[model samples]
Target: MPTTIRYSISDLATYFESTTYDRIMVLCDENTRTHCLPLLTKWIPHFQIIEIASGETHKNWETCMQIWEALVANHFTRNSLLINVGGGVITDMGGFAASVYKRGIKCIQIPTSLLAMVDASIGAKTGIDFQDIKNTLGTFYEAELTIIDPIFLQTLDKRQIISGFAEMLKHGLIADKAYFHQLLDYSFENTIDWPLLIQQSLHIKSSIVAQDPTEKGLRKTLNFGHTIGHAIESYYLEKENALLHGEAILYGMIAALFLSSKKFNYTSAFISALENFTEKHLSTAKIKIDITQVMKYIQQDKKNKGDQFLFVLLDAENQILYDIPCSQNEIIEALNYLHD
Candidate 1:
């Protein structure tokens, strides 16, 4: 069965009334613990808290060990409940931990950041980074429930919010052209409609995941920008000035657009519009291309089959094409486009 998703905080409280657990633990980062937990505690006041340091840098085995130790120390049984409350890192790692502990435990996801609400928490994909590779260790574990409350979005800064917005843009690009255009009109500076946009984005993702839960076919389209994007992300993972996942994806999408133009004649008008949109909404920050290092990461990507390079590209009609092979020169040219 698909995971149950609740839109309001009140729904979460109401849910607890009908559910029972031997022990309950809320896993969050320091940031979420400070900003988002108070709201949750008001409704579900009896759970123990396990707080970890925030950021992608900490989403690894060490952190999982911390959570597992906490669970063990707290005597968390298989019947216990682990509620994950934070952005992508928390939901991903929390779900993985819960799924692995004592075989499996019931877990709930309460995504606090915009990225998590729209993409990470909605999908049943759970993981932790291993040896600096993104989502290297993971399980296809579904949460009991995923609670999405837009109120937590208030706690994020513009950068973090924009980071999450990148995934929303990808959702539109892959599935709904109407939504793609609708999101093009969105501006961070102006008043926004969070609930409607969130709902739409979540719907696109959920519908796609429902069709291809294990990514055998249609779901690969959802990775349109992620192949190159993840490579760029991994390349910067060790740097002092690391790139956020969404920021790297924006670059990846631009590169993918270039590839699409080569493969399927994507119009100049659309390309120009995308450029204008990025100019308006994104930062002027540029990442110098290190093609050698990036190619290494790309080769390591999970989507690759044997030694061939495969990507999810867009067609002239803005439709997605998965497992499209591109030559080394083409891939380098796409990355080079970002440099210019």
Candidate 2:
């Protein structure tokens, strides 16, 4: 069965009251500790805290060791529940640690960031970066539940919110045409109904994730912009506050849309709207990684089979097509198109 996703404090309180869990803990980062932690303290005042360094760079084995060591010191058992609070890094790392700690345990996701609430926190995948690739080490353990309260988004900065919007754009492009149109017209500068939009995005992704929990077929569509997006993320990860995952993805969406137009005869109006949006909001830092470097990372993408690069491309009508083999030269041309 699919895990229940709720958007209320009462639901969270009910879970905390459950006798199924013998112990409870929160895995968070420095930023989440300062900004988002207090929101949970009222409900989970006695819950153990597992704080770790923030950022995609720290989503590694070393950090996993920190979580594992903390649980050990606290004598956490299989009946213990770990609620992952914060964005992608904390949920990914926390889920991984909880799933593998003695084979398996219970995990609940409390997604504070827009990206996590809408996308990352919904999927059952748990992984940490290994070698130079993204999400290279992980498992298929699903979370027991995910709590997404829009109130936590108030703690996020504008950049983080915009970064999260990128995935929403991808969600629209891949699933709902009306939603794609809605996103095209949606403005990030002003306030809107976040709870509504969050539900919309989560439904699209969750439906896909449920069908292909193992990512064998339909689930691969969720990786729409990630093929190149993840490579760009890897290339620039070392830089200070460098491209957050969604920024690189917005850049990749630019390239993917370009390829979609060229290869699939995608409508000019839709493509142009996306292009104009990119021109207005995104900057060249979005693709500061040299073409060669991005390509090198793409070659290492886990989705690629053997020597060929497999891309999930969209049709002119915005329908998704997976595992389409893309050539290096064609990819370079797409980069040139994105640059232009």
Winning candidate number (TM-score): 1
* TM-score on alpha carbons, each prediction: 0.97, 0.95
Poorly placed runs, candidate 2 (over 4 Å): 284-286
Poorest 10 consecutive residues by lDDT, candidate 2? 280-289
User: For residue 182, what is the lDDT in candidate 1?
Assistant: 91
Q: How does model 2 fare in lDDT?
A: 0.84
Clashes of 2: 0
Candidate 1 lDDT score at position 75: 95
Residue 287's lDDT in candidate 1 = 63
Which residue pairs clash within candidate 1?
Answer: none
Against the unseen true structure, what C-alpha lDDT does each candidate score? 0.88, 0.84
